[model samples]
Target: MTSDAPAAADKRPRKADGDRLSKLARHKHIISQLTAAPTLRASELAAVLGVSGETIRRDLMELQEQKLINRTYGGASRPFALEPALTDRKAIMIAEREAMAAVIADLILPNEVLMLGAGATTFHIARRLASRAHDITVITHDYAIAAALAVNPSIRVLCCPGRYHPNEGYVFGTQTIANINSYEANRAIVSATGISARGANDADDEAGAIYGAMAKRAAEAILVADHSKFDQRALTVFAHWTDIDRLVTDRQPEGALATALRAAGTEIIVAQL
Candidate 1:
């Protein structure tokens, strides 16, 4: 009697058996797209990948479960919680931040008082200022920024007295706000976690309050944010577009965000990287 077992070749793994591997690849592609653009609609993703809507939805679910993306109403976006620590942020968008910092540095004229906010991008601006040999006064709440600029004898670094946040390496409190109110600066260069039609937002309340105080005390408030910050929303709206005189970014704003920025009369300077 002949055995009923199938042939060895027929029992071997086939292309259909690689569904798990294919799904993993698809998941990575979805994450990459989300990283490039803060938000991505499911329909657009499905069409672009030539996959069914149901498959896209399933992939999004898996990605969300893995904490690689945040599921929104009709799409997905990068997770928005607290802003990353300064050191962690220093490694992100380095090229864009450097270009933006250079642009901001050029905007600074010698002898003008400047207020710098606490953020990785602003820290880059502080480093840029360190390279300058001009005499200027700098007031900031970020300890890292103050330390970075301390090497410049021509620049005076003033630290705001407040409760220190060790994790962020910054000081922010009622005292910090009052200190910012006591002095006026020619320009305030600030960065935020997100920038949308709503406003320039921060992930922390204290930091957001400090940004508002700084912007309020400056003659001109310029916001420095990279392309990744667009279309994203954070916990706190620190300053409205009306409060900002200019925005220096790596890329041009698009859609509603672009329209809002134009309507607000905020001069947009796209840094050449």
Candidate 2:
């Protein structure tokens, strides 16, 4: 207050420091990652943190623990449970996920038996199929996917039996695996919870495990995921690059992933959006 002394201004706490909800709001943001796919590049995420890459990784671990979202290579995303949170995720990625699925369906041939996995993207693809073709047997563990084909008598639809996750709109469990194993699919179109540099498809929970089981029984494995899934590892890995027949995505997957998948002998098809 003296002329010789520098006057100190009153200090207020940052909103992040003052509001308990500031913490909860942080939790809410990870759900945004689910919607921000294809555009959420890992390198860009590391840049946003203002910390070293390693620090951001540790931060992601804490988010993963809250079950707000699963950890990805450079980010975090909403968990698979059906909830208002998932609905939020769905709204953001609608155009991109739809584009990726459109690219995947372009390769389908008539009279092929296909196993569709659970995820909003898969549900979108099934809807497209319902309009375009008939006499194709679609096998799936997802109620939403099965229902999309319900009125189509020409397309034979098989539903797997197991525990149904109402949030994910899919059936998954040992019973689901048993049902999936009973039939052989010509090609299996599935989605992933995340993709790792190791070129593996990872899932957030046990539902992922059942999808992996059915994928192995198919003659060809075609993964239908958008660019957002790249550079992340989930709770369980369903298949490796060596196991995948093709990767159908909205954009070309980048980073260590493109090389790893190619080296593993997997063909990547970038869907034209």
Candidate 3:
């Protein structure tokens, strides 16, 4: 009787926990989890949220209808995506970003010029270079990246001239593109909001334009992104796989993306955690 009572108590709905959360709050959590992982099973989500399996299924159904997630066999996956604000993104995947940054920084040689695009992962690379790289020039449209690279006295940082995007903390427009075109770089290190068989992509067209310009102007284009970006399709494909020289990421891309990279002859460098 005592054992049965304890088991019953354990099975009771956590009314003080997940039950108190609103549907909107649960949806937000579901999205957050999906962002950090490749896929989520319905059973795991039910256990974590302390909700009934049916409730979780209903939530997944609604999110799928809204195109927020891709429903899988008893699971969910990241959709062809949209990203949050830059500030919000900066807070996510810190360790993965830092690991990728380290690998990218090591690939850079002294006295080389690099074109950096605007994104949270690239920002982490900028910070890594500031501490480790030497005698390098970094040209970027992101004011924050320029400031980060400036901390290294040996690195020369140039900010592009263009209209400032208040929310993104970067410059973008005709001037930015022209300026990027004028400088030939040893390498371009950029981040994408998504990477699918279609190639590297961004959620914002203006940001995509900047990344595209950088890739064209540089001798080698290196894309630094973490695993969560895998299979995500975004608003614009900035650089085709053939245009990219190397990909620095925390995980090896599988499925169609791996096939595309192999076909395009782009090198994949998986950073050690």
Candidate 4:
């Protein structure tokens, strides 16, 4: 005896199922956004996802628990990952760094005293300066920079004394800061892990301290960062945009970052690579 039934009407879609699917979709969208940018504010994400801030917070908590992202103050950031070592970084963006180095080299005058920071881009700048016939005195905490300029008889390299960080190929500590303060330079050329409206940032605390001291003692402070660094946040904010005299980068900064740099009165130099 077959009874024609509609299989219980396909068991009407469950409310919980729809809610779970929606939450899953939201998680995916959040991950995609974070993958594109290093960090995103909770409020921004909430608006984009058309959800309440509270909902976003809960989602962030779950994502953090899953080791998908890191929860920051009022925001979420990509999961913590160690920055690449200097040797690896040296090859990452050669063309852009070279162009930036050339621009920076043009700014230096013969016999001017310079303070150079430790990083791949700064290393390139040191190389460019070394190639010039100009006689300059350079005070630096980077072993690579010192070595790069060593062959140039026209350039005098003064190495800052401190504890050496192997991966960074540089020296940093209290001694480094003290050494930086001992002499005031005409210009300080530095690099950063990130730059945003908040400030110029670094991944290492000790290195940040050295950079800060150098910027303070120098007559002019120049920051060399790439377009990739714009709007990014690092572990330590070493200098604000107002503290920098010039910002030399591979591309022009856009959006809030550009506005903030302008408001801070930092001269922006876009290197034509």
lDDT of 4 by residue, 221-247 (tens): 999999878777678889998899999
Tens-digit lDDT track of model 2 for 1-273:
459877785342225455423434433443455544423444544454333566556556776786756666555554643223446656777888878767767777889898888777788888888877768998888887899977677889988888878777777788888888899999888887677655555545576687677679899988877777777666677788888888888778775788788788888887666
Candidate 3 stretches with Cα past 4 Å from truth are 1-66, 69-79
* Rank list by lDDT: 3, 1, 4, 2
Task: Kindly give the stretch of ten consecutive residues in candidate 4 with the minimal lDDT sum.
Answer: 11-20
- Tell me the number of clashing residue pairs for each predicted model: 0, 2, 0, 0
Candidate order (TM-score): 4, 1, 3, 2
Q: Each candidate's root-mean-square deviation in Å?
A: 9.1, 9.4, 8.2, 8.3
Report the candidate with higher lDDT, 1 versus 2.
Answer: 1
Q: Choose 3 or 4, whichever is better by TM-score.
A: 4
Candidate 3 residue lDDT tens string, 1-273: 246443434542344653556778778888988755768999988887777899999999999999999999998988867889988999999999999999998898999999999989999999999999999999999999999999889999988999999998999999999999999999999999899887999999999999999999999999888998888888899999999999999999887789999999999999988
Q: By the lDDT metric, which is better: model 1 or model 3? A: 3
Q: Which residue pairs in candidate 2 have backbone atoms (N, alpha carbon, C) closer than 3 angstroms, thus clashing?
A: 38-228, 82-167
Winner by lDDT: 3
lDDT agreement with native, every candidate: 0.88, 0.72, 0.90, 0.86
Q: Write the residue-wise lDDT of candidate 1 on 57-147 in tens digits.
A: 9999988888788999888997764577778899989999999999988888989999999999998999998996379999999999999
The C-alpha TM-scores of every prediction are: 0.76, 0.70, 0.75, 0.80
